[model samples]
Target: MNRLARQSLLLAGLLLPVLPLAAQHVDHAGHGASHARDPMAAAIAAPSRTPANVARDKYRHPAETLAFFGVRPDQTVVEYSPSGGWYTEILAPLLSAKGTFYALQPVGRNLDGYKTFLAAKPDVYGKVKLVPFPDQLSLIPAGSVDTLLTFRNIHNMVMNGTEAATFKSFYDLLKPGGILGVVDHRLPEARDSALEKTSGYLKVSTIRRLAQAAGFEYVGSSEINANPKDTADWEKGVWTLPPTLRNGEVDKARYLAIGESDRMTLKFRKPAS
Candidate 1:
């Protein structure tokens, strides 16, 4: 072949391998560009969130709680048993732009209510993926989630005798190095497992043991949701504190002063290996 023809062939050969990589970069950028500019901020500011939900920020500390778990704007997060979508209001909008938020619910009356809540606010919650968790968390795919969060729900799992299975499922669903953010009513001291069931309280030691047994490493704990005033020995357990005030308006003022239960916020991780 002539000199010009050979030079052209050499240039083409050098560029061939780089073509696929260039295409991949463009594809990734395009995908990311389609997401909201700042999902976390947008979610927090979403107008569709109910006023009552916003009012609870003082006790729930949604932003700080999620931050403690290292939740990123772009991640696949699954919230276990979002019965009333309290956190859903924040998560759906925050993740709607760039990440996936899965609301896992069991089969019950709350399921219909949860669906209706999402349907009513399509602009903010339309992207939320609802997974029917039922008994055993059959809906979550193994090693698919970056973060798995459960709020005040562990005691119920223990009460129903599915605690171990549920933890195992959580372990299975997370990617290696994935985070598990657990928030539950705190028991001042370790109590018998059965007694804990009735009190809606759990000891940090017991929680750590359970999570470690399921192959997760206890990374750390945060006091972002702690309320020192809560003695946690109410007549109706944690529910007697605020929101629930199981006694109705009997001690409404007292319970209102205490706010919500003193909760333990913990972070655990699946080993990267």
Candidate 2:
């Protein structure tokens, strides 16, 4: 081959691998730019999600929150107390194709609503597995789950005095090195500890201590769901904020302007033995 042809061929071969990397970009949040799309985004954007739930996306940050949890479509996951199946609609279908999704709702809690939600759409929820927690945790093989998620429910557990049992169950259900993603209303450390029981907010130290006591290592935390406007000292607790706004029309606009509770997103992992 001519010298010019040989030089051109060499340059083309060197550029092939770099071309793919160059085409990809990383966003400020360190997601979405690299790839043309993310499965979690597609799941969150699915038309199957209710308009009400979709409207809450700005406050919930499902895509960034789940991604922070490192959720994948091909892992065995458990969502504790899926409360009204808000995340269920996204998780069930995401894992439906290649992974296992177990909804660990308590029998007397929101289980009925969860059932009705799943029943309403067989195609989206066909692969979901239901296991009543505390009562039916045994149904999920011990140490087999890849990830366990509990969003905005820890305070309820604390209020009901079930946090220890719940955390122990979380440890037992996860495999060694398995992940635990927790999202709950944030209560500043300066706030009265008594508020956690009735106010629907919790201190991060409280959660960390509880998780570590149950034998899980602190992984990290994310601010994807944080809302600065929330003062965390509402009359009816976190519920006094948007979504719940338990106070009715009294000061509704002010609460609406404040938006959802400021939440702390945390991740923990069972020690890999």
Best by lDDT: 2
Clashing pairs in 2: none
lDDT for each residue of candidate 1 in 1-273, tens digit (9 for 90 to 100): 999999999999999999999999999787566544655555666678889888888998887899999898789999998989999999987877678898988767388899998888887788888987755465567899999999999988877778887899889999999999999999977555556888899889888988999999999999999999998887678888877889998979988987998999999999999
In candidate 1, stretches whose alpha carbon ends up further than 4 angstroms from where it belongs are: 1-38, 135-139, 190-193
Q: Per-candidate TM vs. native?
A: 0.83, 0.86
- What shift in Å separates residue 192 of candidate 2 from its native position after superposition? 1.5
Tens digits of per-residue lDDT for model 2, 1-273 = 999999999999999998667656433335544332567766887779999999999999898898899899999999999969999989987887789999999879978888898999998887889888778788999999999999999998899999998999999999999999999999999988988888899999999999999999999999999999999988788888889889999999999999999999999999998
Best by TM-score: 2
Worst 10 residues of 2 by lDDT: 27-36
Error of 1 at 248 (Å): 0.7
Which runs in model 2 stand beyond 4 Å of their true positions?
Answer: 1-37
